[model samples]
Target: MFGNTLYVEKIQHALEQSNFPATPDNLYDPVRYMLSLSGKRIRPLLVLLGADLFNIENIDDALPASLAIEYFHNFSLVHDDIMDNAPLRRGKEAVHKKWNESVAILSGDALLVKAYEQLAFVKVEYIPELLRIFSQLAIEVCEGQQYDMDFESIDSITGDQYIEMIRLKTSVLLGGALEMGAIIANATLVDRKHINNFGVNLGIAFQLQDDILDVYGDPSTFGKQIAGDIIANKKTILYILLKSKLEQEDTQEFEDLLTNKAITSDEKITRMKNLYQKYHVVQEAGELKGKYTHLAYESLQKVNVTEPQKKELYSLADNLMRRTQ
Candidate 1:
């Protein structure tokens, strides 16, 4: 019966109390620093919400899984920043930039270890299934990351390929978090499958929303540089759709503009936005996001829980879909 705000507070308190070795400042400090950064904490919240759906009275039972998800997420961010050569994370200095790449790598590894350590505290009966799912989730995320990198080197990628990549990299973890919570509550297999599907579909929608925001969102609110995808020549859904819509000459121009170093970042962003608007790809992307959102709702509705029990998750999904950041 607790709301999202209370659940978030509980997660924050647990993170604050997490134990880390003090002497090896270089190794552990980056891990601590990365965790301290501002984030939505949506993944962990899903863990609690999943358990709450089953009417689990003592939410504390879900805390270990929540912490595990958070730790793994932050660990991914640390390494992802390094891979992207991103100087900022959560609008502050990135771990690699603040410290050094080697230290950041070590710290990120340490965080992954910490994530497993947290998983060790989950209820004994659920441990085996949780470990299996968590391990698979971890491997899939890596596959997604590798696919993303592979796309960077290629000329074109199908929308299906892109969707699959994002699913593995982003959506699976969300599903895993919720499923872990359901496992802890001893929910039936059918209910677990339904909730996990709900989360996976919702996560796809969430990432699509992110693609839109990256182009049009306010920099201050978005928590990252606007048109960063454009600058990096990322094959976002918008870019992919736009590429498909462009004629041969327009496609050539598009590629040239992206590769042109003479243009300033602002100029590149402005020009790209013009192209996106001209092709109406943003609207198309919105429609694609809506498709996944509908699928998510369908999955949630199929869950055995009563409508009243599902209200918070539905509200959270709505808010996430509408978010500007």
Candidate 2:
């Protein structure tokens, strides 16, 4: 029930309320702005939920590590937007859009460093695991970014590559976040691994759902334009899959749209979406998302969670998998 999740929600709300202006007045303010943006606070919520699963007293003891999770997530987003030249984040101006790339770059770096500063508050016993998980996630995120950039230049990409890219770029952090929470809660190793797998499969389902939404979500609810990925020629799950499946003329039209730098956002989005429909892109993406969702639920069922708790968690997973945007 929502009552059970209220505690995690409160921790997230408190974390946001505790925000303060960045120091030195001239620096790190941009990173601060990115942090201040109205993000869903999902990562921190995961931390609290992970801790609560083990009946950990005073989840606040995990607050610093939880904050680290958020800081690192925002830091990655700041740099990611710059690389993607994305103009908006959380439905507002992106950090790179608000400031010059140099400032954005420096501030993003500071955020990463500051993430470590807060992470130091993890009790001495948790330091090694924290460092190991953080380092591995950091590296994987970079690898994912590189793979994404690589996709821009390649003529074609495989479904496997697309899945791995999203796993690295988007899912690893989710897994790491829950694992970090388990580590802080001092859960059994089996439980920690299971929870981590839960996060991992959940992430795959979440990303695949996003891919499905990119072409089919309601425009108003989706925030961003539908089929925006197709317009950008981004190597999304749908795009790569459709590449090998669409008719030659259909493929050429999609490719031609991408080649045209002059196409309006609305026009490009419309054409790509129309073609996606003609080729059954949305259905294929939906099926892939379902596969991941089933896998995620299977992983969730393997944990020690009581049925009622499992229902609550399943509700969350259902929400993620079924989101419009």
Which candidate gets the maximum lDDT versus the true structure? 1
**Pairs clashing in candidate 2?**
none
Q: Estimate each model's TM-score.
A: 0.94, 0.89
Predictions in order: lDDT = 0.90, 0.78
Q: Identify the runs in model 1 with alpha carbons over 4 angstroms from their true place.
A: 218-223, 264-267
lDDT, residue 136, model 1: 90
Give lDDT tens digits, candidate 1, residues 1-325: 8999999999999999997889699998898898899788999999999999888868999999999999999999999989989898988999999999999899999999999888889888889998998899999999999999898888778777888999999999999899888888888999999999999999998899899999888888876678889998889999888887887767766877788889888888888888899999999888989999999999999989899999999999899888764
* Error at 37, model 1, angstroms: 1.3
lDDT (10s digit) by residue, model 2, range 1-325: 3343675567566566645565754456786688778777788777767776666667777778788888888888989899989898888888877877877888888878877887788888988888898889889989998998888889778888888988898888888887887888888788888887888778987888777777777879877766777766777887788786878767677777778888887888778778777878778787887787787777777778676755656677777776765
Alpha carbon lDDT at 13, candidate 2: 66
Q: Model 1's lDDT to the true fold?
A: 0.90
